[model samples]
Target: MPMQAAQWSKALLADALAPVYLLVGEELLVLEAADAIRRRATTLGYAEREVLEAGPQFDWDNLARAAAGMSLFASRRLLDLRLPGGRAGKDGGAAIQAFCADPPPDVSLLITATEWSSKHESAWSKSVDQLGVQVVFQAPRPNEWGRWITARLASHGLSASSEAAALLAERVEGNLLAAAQEVDKLAILHQGGRIDRAEMERLVADSARYDAFKLTDAAFAGDAARALKVLAGLHAEGEELIGLMGWLVNQLQLVLRLASAEDFASQARAERLWPAREQLFRQALRRAPRQHWLGCLARAGRIDRMAKGRESGEPWREAERLIAAMALPRGSLSAP
Candidate 1:
């Protein structure tokens, strides 16, 4: 059965061992679930751990081989498989189904994917569903965030008044990773005492002031200074680089799609540009040529690799450069 992240702990306590587990989501909840699974597996005698990243060039045979192989010392092994693109092509699908049909008793498979659309419900997913557990991690909604924050605080042996929890929720703005870090910081600073609104106001920086959408808006308005400021603020606030890059890639793709239209009016209509944002899009389109946006998209891919530590050089500096190239006036890209 598909389970929510909140249900994972209790479920694990009830039945900690499973032949296979599939985790799908992009939120930090996925990370927490993975950690919980690992901890429980460790306790259940899955002493050997093997991790594999299934990327474009990954071989499906390796998955089969790993499952078949046995650990030299440990009787039981844990297989941690990560599919970054959340896809198993034809070959991968077949392998997954085959494994599901007769999973190795000595090994436990924990498969994770960043995305899972309707198209992902293939034979492999169905096999996993019938054979093991599937969990989906989603962020809490606005109405649920305060309670989420309060629970996170309690985990650290810290309590907060309702107002303080709401303030913290507002400050983090639904970013669970940021909220978790803030809760940890508060636990250290307050030494596990109750927190109130005034202390929250004084201690918590307004990291929520700049989000990906706001940064994109600033860039689309050709406000290079403001965009750069937001970029710095988000980085300082410990915002996830992958989330930031994903937004930039999406915005650039939208612009590229519209730029190919017959005229500005047609493009605007195709993009469903609201009256408030039409001018901003127009200004953005005018400031740079289509080729510039294409280059930005290409660089966004490189920045993603950099952020993941797959490529060398500083990711943040490259991100700043990409933002300036897209957001600044064409000739003023080198401006301080």
Candidate 2:
């Protein structure tokens, strides 16, 4: 049955009667669920656990040893095998088959790895499916991201304004890592209490990785086309032109911060500005001038006016004009 990381505990209430359970996925939350189950089982008297991580030089003999070893500590033994590559080799496969043919009494074997494509699922995979529970992990969809965020917040005993959640869903745009970071930030600041939209606005607006943060790179590179391309994507996403202007201003601020870095390694110190891509920002500042930021902001202002006015014009064209002005050298264009 399909299950989310948060729901695994409920599913396991009945399924825990089984001696073994398997989890597989790239989602970090899924992996954490698998670990939680293993710990719970360990507390419930399944001792003598053995974990095999599949990597170079991993051999099948370990499985043989696990199956054959007499439990020195507890009545039941648990094997948590992590095969990131998804299958064992010839010798390993045979060992696995033998273990499944007649798994020792009170010995539970759990397996985990990345999911295999239909055509690529290994024989051992089928064998494991027939023998035990298999939990597969898939990334949450766009609609599901909001639910995941809410679930995560509740898991920590927290709540948020519906507007706050809505804005988070809007700004983060289904990026799990970004969502996770935002959740963590809120959790800490609010102390697991209620979070409001004002707090969300204060903390997160532009996606640090891609959103309005990227303006100057396009400008400094003198590629008006690329600058406009970035703006076009943001515009298509329904971002307000004023919102873009605000982020552009923030990016200009980062340029000032970057220039203040004392030396090479001080690039790390520059993290205070962007905090997300300090190294990249430092590199961009190497060839760009602090004055360029003011220039970019001026151009962004004109674009904002065009967007707010009844230009009856494509926002992207105004964005292109903005990029063109920003891409030129500091004095290349007069101030707005």
lDDT of 1: 0.77
Tens-digit per-residue lDDT, 1-336, candidate 1: 587677777878844478889998853566557767888988878888888888899999999999999688857898899887788889988988888989988788889886877677788888888898888777788899899889988877888899999998987777655576567556655755688898777666444433565577767766678678989988897888987888788888988886677666557767765433554566578788777777778888889888888889788998888877877747433322
Please give the CA lDDT of all the candidate structures.
Answer: 0.77, 0.63
lDDT of 2 by residue, 1-336 (tens): 334555566766653435445577754544556656666676767866777876768877888788789888647888877776666777767777777778777888877765544544566656666776666766677777667677777766888777778788886677554566456555555645577888778656444334454455556545567577777777777767766666666666666655665653345443532222443454356546666655666666666666677445555565666567656553355665
Off by over 4 Å in 2: 1-7, 15-17, 205-336
Q: What is the TM-score (0 to 1) of candidate 2?
A: 0.56
> What is the Cα-based TM-score of model 1?
0.62
Could you tell me which residue pairs clash in candidate 2?
none
Model 1 residue 84 CA deviation in Å? 0.4
Instruction: Find the 10 residues in a row with the least total lDDT in model 2.
Output: 270-279
